[model samples]
Structures are given as C-alpha cells and as structure tokens.
Target: MDTCKNCGKPLENPDQELCPACRAVENAKARTRREEKAGHARRRRMNRTTRKMLIAVCVLAVVFTGLCVTATVMYDKYNPDEFIASVDAALEAGDARALKNLLKGEDLTVSDEGAAALCRAFTDAAQREALRGQLEDQVVDGGAQGAFPALGVEKESVFFGYSRYSLTVHSVRLLLSSPVQNLRLSLDGVPRTGEQTADGILYQNLFPGLYTCTVTGTTAAGQAVEGDATDLALLSSVEPTVFSGALPIADITVSGCVNDGAVITVDGAAVEQKPVNGVVTLPQVAVGSTIGMQYTAPWGAVTTASVQFADKTVTTLAFENPVTEGGVPAAGELNTLLTAHYAAYLDALNNQDTALISGCTEEYKAALAQGVVSDTHKANLYVMGTAECNPAAIKSTAADGTARVSCYVKLTYTHSDRESHEETPATAYRVYTFTWADGWKVSASADSTEEAYNTASMDALP
Candidate 1:
C-alpha cells in the first residue's frame, strides 16, 4: 500500500493519505456549489428585465388603440354650421327657455350674426330685450330704436380660407359669425370671422366616404337646439325642398239664405258679400300654420272663424243653417211641392171648368175681381166673354221678409168676336204669397196696361 509522502497515515488497500481526507473532499465540493449559485443569480436577473420590457410594449399598444377609438368618435360629432343655427329655430318659436339656455356660461361678444338672429326672433324692442336677458352674452340697448342692433359683417366671410375645400379633408373650419358677435367658432383650431347670410354655409375637405353633418346656431334670445343628417356620403348630391306664402286655414262652416247675402274674408281681407249657396273658397295654402277668417251675413251681422291649414292644400266652406221666408222647407223641397201644385193649376186653367180651378185661393178670386171692367162689375151676364190668363216668370225681392215672390203674367178677354177670329195680348205682373192655412195665394198684380188697370183699382171701381 502507498501513502502520501507528506503525511504519515495508515493505508487502506495499498494507496492511502490520512483519515481526514474525506473532510477535505467535502470542503472542495462546498466551494464549487458557491460558484454555481453566483452564476444562477445572474441569469435570473437578466430574465426579469426581458419580461418587464415585453409587458411595457403590450400596455403601450393597448393605450394607442384606445386613443384611436376616442378620436374617431369625437370626429364623427364635428360639424361647422351648428355653431349658429340653434338660434334660428328658437326665435321662430318664441321660446323663452331655449333663448335662456343658449346664453348659459358662454364667453362671447355680440356679433353680426347674433344681431340678425335677435332681430329675426323678436320684431319689437321690448320683446328683443327680454330675449337678450335670456340668451344674450350682452344686452346692447339702443334707446333710439333706429336699428341700433344692426349686424356688421366683414367682407372676408364670403369665401372659404382654403383655395377651395377639397372633398377629402374631414377636418372642420368653424367660421366665426362676421363681426365676431356672440358666437364662438374655430377653423382647424384657429379663430376666424362670424356672420350669418342667406347663401348658407359650405363645409369641404371631408374624407371620400359617408358622413353626417350637423348645423347648430342660437340667437341670444333662443335656446340651444340641434339638427343632424346621417349616412350622407361625402361625394353624394344633396337637395332640399322649400315653400312660400302664408299658411292655409281649415274649411269654414256657413249656413244662411243665398240671395239674402253673406260675406267671406280670407287672411283678414274682405273679399265678397252675399255669396251664393253659402260658399266661400280660400286660396290654396302651405302646410303647417294657423289661418284666421271672418264672415258677415246679410244685414251686416258678422262672425269669426279659423283653421289649421295643411301644406299645399285648399279650404272649402259649407253653410251651417239656412233660413227662408214663408216657413217653407228648403228651396229644394219647396220646388217639389210648388211644382206639383203649379202643374195642376195650369191643367185646370186649360180645361176652363169652374171645378178645375176650384183649388184657387180666395185671394186669387179677389185679385180677379179688381181686373173686371168698372161698368160691368156687378152684371151677372157674360159681358166680356171668355177670360184668359197666362202665367209669367217669378222673381224674389231683396231677401228681406218684406219682399217675397212675385210673378209676371198677362190676361185678355173677348167682349165679342167682331170679325171672325180675334185675339188680344195683355201683360201684367202679379205678386204671390203664402199663409199657413191658405197654402198658396195671390197678393197683388200690376199690369203693363197700368193706366187702365189703375182706373179699375178697388177703391176706384163701382
């Protein structure tokens, strides 16, 4: 057995060092473990740094996507014209609340567009001042009332700032109202002019795709209002409809005597009096507004009416209740009863029989008596021969109860046939009347032979 030369030790098997060699081996192994532990710590630190970098990159990507979404939403809501339109609608409606809401917390000076808006909303000084307190940034009192609040617009507002707004730029140019009044506007984050005009506003430089536009303007006396159109393609054509004139009124209900008279007024203008059939026609009207009317009957009695007219339409009028003289039914029903009675009377006169003319009223008999010759009035004998009567056309008086219906007629007589056939023509006018019990009667007769007829008057006759 061999042993370490430096150490005296009991050898086991042939070669051996000392009994403490096992402890030495253990000490060397511990030293190697410490070196490996140091190397492993270095690797773990490097790995943690790589992980932190990857996490930071992911977070940044998410933030960027969110920002993009928010920007897109905000862009969709942008419109250049809405800054001024909120005032117009409120003014037309005369709404106090809307006028007040538009002025709330806004930092602005009175502008030309704002002045016009106020003028359009209120026509009078008192009304305009009240509206200003509600929505105006400042109230300018022109005590003289000589158009002191006139709008002042600069020449620059007529054209866009760009050479020509291309259809592909979506960014907006909020043109300030000319004279920079109460409205605030921005064009690409810069301030410009402020003004309102009839030519309207144009927004260009939009992406070549579908888009929505909203225009809002408010008067100092108007409330905040909004308007928007959706799904409007950027390159698409746009058209709007327009109408003019005062609104129409509803059809009126009228009823009264036709010949008696009535009046028709449209838009407060008196047009006609005593219209036939109680009919009045108004000119066609536009949709969406109230119309006023007045009516006068015969005798100058008047009444009033109104209606909400539809767009592009006409109003018709009808009589409510019609009254006539003699307590007769309507003219239509009177025609029927009168027709039958007159037909029977004509037949009886042709037959020349006493029984045939029996239905004639006592008044008609008296009227006939007045026509008899004065000297032959009491003679029972046939002094004149055959009596002849021909009916004539009917006429009505001025529609008052004093005047009823009168007829023109002719009568002749043959005292004797001197030479063969002989005929005489007589012309006269007779008045017809009616009573509850008498049914129909003759009131008076005035013949064309007035001179001779007057000589035969009842007071003059024997």
Candidate 2:
C-alpha cells in the first residue's frame, strides 16, 4: 500500500494516496491556495483601475488651472477699462465695499469703517466729478498697454463727497483753550459732562442747533470764574469752536538794587521771571497774588523783596536799600578808609592782636575772641601773614548815617599744629558796619555773621 506522504496511516485502497482525513486536509489546502491566488489577481486589477483614475484627475486639474490663469489674464488685460469704469461708478455712489473690491494690492486690508471714513472725507461734489474724469482719461490713454493705473486704495487716501446720510448725522464740538480743573460745563441749559484732553476739553456729539454753552471753575485762591457763549447757532461741524476769555489779573513791576535774574514768587507759587537790563517785570499776576523777589549779589550779598498784589496797572515796588554814613570824607574816600581798616582788622585777627578790634562792636569782638583765639588755642593751631580784603561795593548812607559795605577777603596763612605745619587758604564774604567816631573806625558789629571758608585739614577744635 502506498503510504500517503502524509500521516503514517496505511492507505485504504491502492489508488488512494493518503488516509481520508489526510486527503481531505490536502484538498482543503489546495483550494485555499487557489482562492488566495484569485484574490491577488483581483487586487492587481483594482490597483490598475485606481491608478488610471488618479492620472485622469491630475490631468483635468492641470488643464482647469491653466484655463483659469488664462481667463484671469485675459480679463485683466482686455476688460481693465470696464473694471475701472465700475470702480468709478462705485466711488461716485459712495459704495465702500464695491470700491474695496475694485482696488487690489497685497498690502491692502481696508475695513468697512475705514472705507466709509475715506469716502466721507471729500465733502465737495466737484472733487468727485474730477476724480471720475481722471479715471476715464487713464482708461482712454491706456488703450493697449493694459494699464489699470493703480487705484492705490491702500497707498493713497481717496476722499470722495460725503453721502447725504452722513451730513444728517454730523454734530458740533466745542474746544476750550485751557483745561480748567474740576470744571462744570452746560449746554442748552442741560449739564453735559465731558473729560479733559491734553490741549483742552472737547464736548462731542452735540446736535447742530441753537444753544448756550457755559463753563465755570473756582480759582486756586477761592475766586469763582464763569464764562459763557450766548445765542450760538453752531451750524457747521467743519470749523472748530474755540472758547477763550479773560481772567482777572494784576500787573506789577519790581525794581531795586537786586541783581538781574531774580526769582519772583506770586502767592507762594513761583512765577517764571525774566529780566531785561536788570529789571524784573511781572506781566500777568492774579489778583491778590503775593509777590516776592530774591537774588544773590557778588560776595554772597543776598537781597529779598515781597509785596501784596492788587488788581490795577503796573505797580512799582522798590526794595529796601542798605544804609551808609556820610561825613567830611566823601563816600568814595570813606570806602577807601573802610577798605584799609578791614584789611588791618583781618591782619590783627590772624596775629591774635586783641588791641586792633577794641573799637569793634561787642558782638563782633566776642565772636573774634571765641571763634579765632579760643577755638584755635584748644586745637593747638597758629595762623600767620596778613589776610587780603577786597571791597566789592558800598551802599549809600541811610537817614541814620549808617552804611553797609560788602567785601571779599582771601586769607592765606600757614596753619600749624604743635606737631606739623600746612599752608591753608581761606575765603569769606564780610559785611562791615562803620559809625563815624572822628575817623572811620571798625565797628564791633556786622550786618550778619561774616561767612568764613577755610580749606585747612585740621582736627575739629572746641
């Protein structure tokens, strides 16, 4: 028996190649292989069909794209005049969206509101007619060049006449010159509140009609100011309505022995003061404004003046002048003698000569004793050489025959401690008071404490 080249069971019949189960299994395997082969052939046929369909689609797409591009080019080239005519029609009719569509550029992105504003900016009918004529001229001259002549809606600002609708809704606005703080404004007997801007306050959205506008505010000094525009028609929104009026002010001029460029203050508020040829003039000063002046002279001589402001013409205020003594020695001769005395006084103080200042005021003598000898003694310091005094100016003698003069004194001396030595330079502004007692004598008193400056590096004495 031929053993089936399968399961090792003996063949039932000679012709039977394998056992029943093995024959059945082999037959099923062959059938399965044939079905798999048929499926592969069907898939291949379907793949060929799909590939042919894709090729057809791609070819159609290319043809369609080419046709579209050709159509666009032909339309732009031949029908550009027709397109421009349509745009002119749209602009003349104030059609924003239509105009936007006609104007083309990569940079253009006009919103509905922008287009409307652009159209309304041109209020003249003549401008619109002229613009249309210009467009027609371009189209005629272009002929074969295909020149659409850039509408430039994005680059240029085209203003056409306003539509009748915008004219109906236009409103009047009032602009104030100066913004009054905490302001109250009323229009047409109705309180219309508004906020302040940098230049002024703007009242917006007002109907174009007859109205009365009033603005009121309180000044910093508790004075009430009110201004009003009466029987105002406010017909046109084209022109700005500027409201400005006068405020109560006082004018004053300050002149005296004070130096130029003096600071002038009004009611404790610093006013911008400028001097022309050494005179300060306050052109506009508020009523009841407190006025004051301050400036520094050479040698640290500071003069100050203050006065109350009244509403009137330019009021002149004179500063209090310094007093000086007059005798047989003229003012110039007296100044010369005073200069010599001041020089001697400084020299004696440097040498610790108490006898030289015996005629000086008690206050000055005491200051010299304590500030000079006593202070230096405690610090183990000794000053050498005569001090230099340069007279700057001499004021006229007062009714009391008392005069005040300014001097710049540079005192250079060798400062010595018990251990080492150093050359010290000192500068001071000294104001001397002299009362004629026979000859010019150094009065013990000065107008103010003499300002002394010393650059000597020494330990702080008592």
Candidate 3:
C-alpha cells in the first residue's frame, strides 16, 4: 500500500479505491462548478438590466401623462377668453352662429351699471341682448371690464372739484366701454346733479373753495361709472377729493345664550327671551348704518356684536319662537286638545305660518302682555276635536288687582311627520301657572330643549 512493490506504481487501499483516471474526473468536476458559477453571475447581471429598462419605460409614461394634464388645464382657462374674441369677430363679420354659441354660457346678472352701458352701446333689444350676454358672461378677472365684468371702457373722467379749481383727471386703467354707456352724474352733499350726457362735462357755477364731489352715474348696460372730482377754480385747478359710497344699511341685531332668570337689553330697551340659546333680534335698522349691540349672558357673562352693518337697504326684526318647558309655546298645552291644535298647526305649516292655539280670556291677556300676540298679528287658534284643558287643575286668580289663581299646569307637547312640519309627537314637559286675569303664564319649568327641537317638526315624522 505504501509503495509499488514492482514498477514503482502508486498503490491504493480498499477505502481509496480510485486510480489517476478517477483523480482526473474529480478535477473536471471542479471545472464544471466554476463554469456554473459564471453562468449564474451572467444571468444576475441580465436581470438587473431588464429591471432598469422597465423603470425607464414607467418614467416616460409618467412624463407623458403630466404633459397631457397641463395641456387640459391651460385649455379650460383660455376657452372663455377665446370665446369673447370670437364674439367680437362675429359681430364685425355678422356671423350669427358664433354669437349664439357665445351666449350659451351666460349667467344673467341684471346690474344697473350693465343696463346703462347696454343702452349706450346698442339701439334695440337685440343689440342690447347680445351685449347683455357679454356682460353676464363677464368675470371679475380679465381686468374689471374683461370677461365676467365685461363693461369695458378705456377712459372715464368726472369734471368737478374744490376751490381754486376742484377737479379730477381720471387715468383710466381697465375702463372698457366705448365713450362709456349709461352716463350718470351724482354730486355728494349737493342738492342738484349736472345734466345727463355722454360727453363728460359737468358745469356748476357755485362759489367754490375746496369741496369733494363724486360723479356717480352708471354705464348704459348698468355698470357703475365714477368721475373723480377734478378741482375747478374759475381760473385755477386743485386736485379733487375722492369719496366712495357704501351700500346702504337696512337692519341689525344682537343675540346670545342664557340659562334661567337672565334679562337681555338692546340699547337700554328690555328684550325678553326664554332660557336656552337666547337670541335677541333687533328691529328696523336703516340700511348702511353700522349698529352696535351688547349682550349680557347668564351669570353676567356678556358678548357685544361689533358695529354690525347691513347693505340690503331695509331690515326688520325676526324672532325665533321663545323656548318653553314644552320647547315651543304651541306644542305644550292640552293633550285632549292635541287633535285640534295639531290640525291648526298643520294648516299653518302648509301655509308657512305659525298656529295660535288658546283664545281663552285669561290666556289671551297673558299672551298679549308676554308679547306672544300683537294687534298686527293674525291669530290662528287650534280647533279642538276632543282635546281639552283640564279646567279643574288650572284655576285663575286676579293679578294687578284683577284677582288671580296660580297652579302648576303640565303641558305635554308631541310632534309627528309631514302632516306636522313642526312639533314632533315626542312628549316634552312644560309648567304653566295661571293667574286670575293672566290665565296661563310660565312660572317654573324644564328647559324647552332646542337641541332636538329642529327634529320636532311634523314634517320629520313617519
């Protein structure tokens, strides 16, 4: 085993049975493993290349999509401007279809400035209508008289001013009307205005120091036109003082929330409210007047609405129904009277009004004093089918020397659906105390919760 006994041949034992031939085979096997490793590495590199190509294609797709979106947004923004230009071209060329297409997107806004401007621009309704379409389609952008606000004028001026020579020379920026339409001349603090004319010359012969004048007349289609007061002295000129008028104030009010036993006052006048989100509504405010209001909440917590102003020219007092132990005053009274009250309330709801239930003398007096009913208010009482007030439980005594009675009257209010736009059939409790002459007045009661009150309407029930 250790050496070749004859011819120097290498010897192998039983455990090492292979010869040189077998050794060569083992070497070839090692070569095969190396070749397989190289092939695996090549495949890995190929896979990486494939992944990069996929990524590149996706990036290109994203870029293409982004460009498409940008193009769409640009198209929408410019379409309206393009339409306006087309309308102008059609007017010049007498192309009816082009004008008709442009008119389709109009949203009508009948401004006085627009009416005046139209009158100036066109001779008849057809011409005016076409321009009206233009005005309606106009936008606030596009430089005042552009697009949505299309009362276009290039130059506008108002000739007036203080002493020396009160006057203003208007350097128009976005004015678009040709010679401008609907010329109006209003002088501030002055009793009279200059004659109406397309030519912007106002002549006032009054002795002048320095005075502010506002020439406000609108264009024909009704766009507002202002002429800056140019100071005109008989022999000199001063810069005109400018003043801007605000829309008139019509009404204003103050309101707040409260618990029990809190009083509300408006400008020192006592206003009444029931506990639970108490709101005080003021009546008869002049348009354009900035109103001041102060509210004292429960426990002396207070809120004051700042100089609140309105512009709609007229304002009136609006009262939300006083919250009662039975929520609203109407639904709390008689269970037996529910059918009658329900019908009356239903009729009122149908007509968009409130129903008045009780008409008894004592209750009437209480209602009147409490401001529940007034002479100007039309009363709609509930007609009783079978419902009755337990007269025995409620006894009246006089008050203010009229004699009286005071007792707790439980008023359970309920409301149900469409037949009942308000007043859900759900029961709420109220305490009613009657005095001899005052009939039934609220003494002590549970909070007429308004949280679920909006849901109490008959219109909401099944």
Candidate 4:
C-alpha cells in the first residue's frame, strides 16, 4: 500500500502521488491561485491609470500656483496699497536695499543719497518697532490706515471725535542775542519733536489739553539754553495755541536720600528719567513760578516739597523720608542729637550715675553689674578728674536712616587705697548705635565682640 503525500491517506495504487480526497483539495488550491493572479493584473492596470491622473492634476495645480504668484507680484507693483505694504515690510525688516527698490519716482531715484535717507528713516529701533506693530495690526485686521509717511504713503482715514489739535512753537532772539539751534521740545513731560530754526516748532494732531512745553537748545557759542513755558492751553482748532519764549532758565538742583529707584515729579508732572542716581538736577525750570515737587520712594513712601522762585536762581533741596513720619530726624539734626547725647552720657559717667549706665545697652548693663561697676568694687574706685566724651564722626546710615556714632572719651581715674595722689589718664574710643522710634536711642548689642568699646563697663569705674 501507498499513502497520499499531503494527508497520508492509503491509496489502492502505490504509484499515485496522492489519494483522491487529497487530489481534489490540490485542484481547488491551484484554481484559486490562478484567479488571484488575474485579479492582481487587473489592479495593476487600474493603479497605472490613477497615477497618470494624479500626476496631471499635480502639474496643473503647480501651474495654477505659479500663475497666482505672478498675478500677485504684478498687482503689487501697480497697486499703491500693495506698494506701500511692500515698502513697509522692507522698512520693518530694516532692509535698506529692499526699501530703496520700493522707493522710486521721478523726483526720487534709487541712488546713494536715496538709500542713505531710507536707512536713516528706518535706523531707529524704536521707530521700526512702531512701524512693525502698525503693520501687524493692519495684517491682522485687513485695514489700511496709519501708512508710512516717510515712504510717501498717506493715511487712509483719521478717526474723528478725538481731542487732536496742533500747535506751533518758536524761539525769539532779542536784539543783542544770537539765534538758538537744534531746539528740542518736550510736550506733557515727553520728548515730542525737535526743530532747528528759531522760527517756530509745529506739533500737529496732538490731543487738545494743557500741555507743559519745555524747550532746550544750545546757543551759537555752544552755551546751553533751556526754559519751560508750561501749561500752554490748546482749547480748539479755532483757538489754537501759539507759544514763544526766550531761554533764560534757572538751574535748580534737587538732592536727597531718596531710595535708589525713586521717581521725582515737578509741577505735578512726572519727569521722564533714565536710571536716576538719587539726585535729579533740572536745568530748564521756568522762573517766577512756585515749583511743586513730589518724590516717590522705593519703599512706597511719598513726600512733597515746594520751591519758591523768589528766593534765588540756584537752589538745593533735601527731601525727608515720610515713612518714619517725623520720628527720625534729618542727617544734620541726627548728628547734633548724637553729640548732645554723648555729652550727657559722659556727664553721667563722670558723676557715677548708675541709673544712666543701666539705661544703655543690655550687654553694657550686664558687664557693668558683673565687672568693675559691682557694688563691692565701687567703694575702692575713685574718679581723680572729669570725663570728657565728644562725638567724633557719624558713620554711614542704614536704610532706615540709623547710624553708628563714634566718640572719643578722655578720663582720669585712680584707686582710693593708692598712696600717691597720682591719677591714670585713659582715652577710649566708643561707638553708639543710634536708631529712631519715637525718639533717638542708643542701640545695644552683645559686648563679647570687640568691635566697639564697652562704654557701660567703663562708666562704672570710679
């Protein structure tokens, strides 16, 4: 007997490769493979047709895209709005060459001079940032307004019902005086415009209000000239403001112990300052007017002072910190108080007043009671002469205006049992920490450190 090759079924004929049941299964598998091969050929034909259609569609799409880009470039070249937008993009990017390409007219040629002008127009980082902000807003809203005038683009519209107005300012020279040049004008405490001629300065489209105009310039001999014609009113278009002035400003110096980041306001307007170093000197104060000032300290304390012009041209002002609320005296006043306190302290020591000695530092009191000033030791000690203590110097003050006062004390002392009437003259340097609460008092620290003299123990000596 023989077996089928696939299923191991017995066959009657030993020469057969498979039994009848296995042979039928092999025939079905062969037919299925043939059908599959036909189906794959049909799919390949369909795929080839689809790929050709896709390639044709892609080619048309690319052509359409190129046509659209070309149309846009042509439109932008002819359209004024699009042209101005191109110029703005160039200026915003600080591309002088691109801006020169866009700036072309019969009167304006793309030359070295034209390129230099364009560069200067967009060289200012602040002005470029302003233009970029304007461009971004226009792009977002699809609106056309606030065009770049330096590129010869006019604003499309101006919003009405606003407080916009115009004013012309000029400097006048007296008969014997030379002309002023490069005069810069500040409006409402901000630098607005600069005009070189003495004819007048024009500020157009400004909000109508009472603006403080300060003019500054240098004379022919390079002498500085500055003055303020403040509070010039611009009521309406019909009643426009025209301000003129001669530069005879009174130089005023403002100095004080204001906090590092403090702000100074003059005549109720906060002046624009860049990193003030605690003192602000105003070179353009108007004469014949009382100047009201307010200082804002870094710790949120505010104090105000006024300067009267009737006094003198050059004036100095020292501002006091209102945070302490008059509890802390000024520096000079504090020095005087410290000197008096040192004298009183010395007098107490000379008279051997234990009460005053106890009123000093806690460390001083402890040292006095345990050491030389003990009751057991007091009887043996004798002060052969008077004690003299004088405040020699006041050190740098703390943030709260407290300071350490150094004093030099002279004293002569001896023991009562000594046979000779000779005295010991001793000189000691003492430092007293002075702080303010309701009044100035000597601050105390431990006496273990030898940083300052132990005044309490010394005072206890006879």
Query: Against the true structure, whose lDDT is highest?
Result: 2
Superposed on all Cα atoms, model 1 deviates from the true structure by an RMSD in Å of 20.6
Q: What would the per-residue lDDT of candidate 3 be over residues 1-462, giving only the tens digit for each residue?
A: 544443344656534444556657778999999999999999999988798888999999999998788667655544444444554555455444443333311223333332322223333347545543543334323233322222331212222211111011111111111234443433334544433324333443322222334444432223344555643212112222222222121224434333333454433344443334444444433333333334332212233333333445334333333332211123334343334434454344334443343323443434334333433323332222333233334433322223322222233334334344444333442323322223323232223333323333322211
Of the two candidates 3 and 4, the one with more favorable lDDT, higher being better, is: 4
**Candidate 3 weakest ten by summed lDDT:** 162-171
lDDT by residue for model 1 (342-411), tens: 4444334433333433233566544443334334322222222222222223333334323333332223
TM-score of each: 0.25, 0.30, 0.18, 0.25
State how far residue 284 of model 1 sits from its true place (Å). 5.6
Error of 2 at 306 (Å): 5.9
Q: For model 4, how does the per-residue alpha-carbon lDDT over 129-234 read when each residue is reduced to its tens digit?
A: 6655554555434444433422222223323311211111112111112245566777656776533334465554443223456777763334455764655544
Candidate 4 residue runs with Cα over 4 Å from true position: 1-367, 372-379, 389-396, 418-462
lDDT of each: 0.36, 0.51, 0.37, 0.48
Across residues 1-462, which tens digit of lDDT does each residue of candidate 2 receive? Answer: 667767877776878778899989889999999999999999999988799898999999999999888777655544545555665566567876875555432323445643544354323466456555655554445222211122222222222321111111245567665433456666645777665777677776554434566767655433455654554444345554666423454356766634456666766666667655556677645566666666643223345677766645547755555222232234455445555555555556566665665545555666666554554544344343443333333332322223333333343444455465554554333444454444445554333223331321112110
What shift in Å separates residue 309 of candidate 2 from its native position after superposition?
6.3
- Order the candidates by lDDT, highest first: 2, 4, 3, 1
In model 3, which runs have C-alpha deviations exceeding 4 angstroms? Answer: 1-43, 81-125, 128-192, 195-462
lDDT score at residue 60, model 2, on the 0-100 scale = 100
> In terms of TM-score, which candidate is stronger, 2 or 4?
2
After superposing candidate 2 on the true structure, give the runs of residues whose Cα lies further than 4 Å from its correct spot. 1-170, 179-183, 188-190, 217-225, 228-233, 249-263, 268-284, 287-290, 294-462
Off by over 4 Å in 1: 1-7, 10-237, 243-257, 265-279, 284-317, 324-374, 377-402, 405-462
Pairs of colliding residues, candidate 2? 323-402, 323-403, 324-397, 324-398, 324-402, 324-403, 360-444, 361-443, 361-444
